[model samples]
Target: MSSDLSLQQIAESVTKSVLNATDKDLEGFQKIIDETIKVRESHRNLQRMIKSYSTTMIQRS
Candidate 1:
């Protein structure tokens, strides 16, 4: 399986878990939320890095 597919699967599972969680599951839900935020932040940073690198390459040509 590709990394993208795996990540998508993991995200789906987390979403379902959060939706079905009870009050007792608050800690689990919090962990999921935190992980999601970290993933989003990482993704944004990666995009910015790639954009900067690509822009530099274009300018160097």
Candidate 2:
């Protein structure tokens, strides 16, 4: 499978695995939330990098 497909599978697994829980799962939930936030920030950075690279290429061309 492609990397996107793999990631989707992993995300689905995590969602399904935690769909039902209680206060005892707080630690697990916190870790997931933090990881998700980090992933989102990383994606934003990647988008910015790509935008900058394309802008420079367009200017040079």
Per lDDT, the best of the predicted structures is 1
Query: lDDT per residue, candidate 1, 1-61, as tens digits?
Result: 5456676787887787778879779787788789999999999999999999999999999
Those runs of model 2 whose alpha carbons end farther than 4 Å from true positions after fitting are 1-24
lDDT of 2 by residue, 1-61 (tens): 5456576787788786677766679687889789999999999999999999999999999
Clash count (model 2, backbone only):
0
Model 1 spans with C-alpha error above 4 angstroms? 1-24
Assess candidate 1 and give its lDDT: 0.87
What TM-score do all the candidates reach, one by one?
0.62, 0.62
lDDT of 2: 0.85
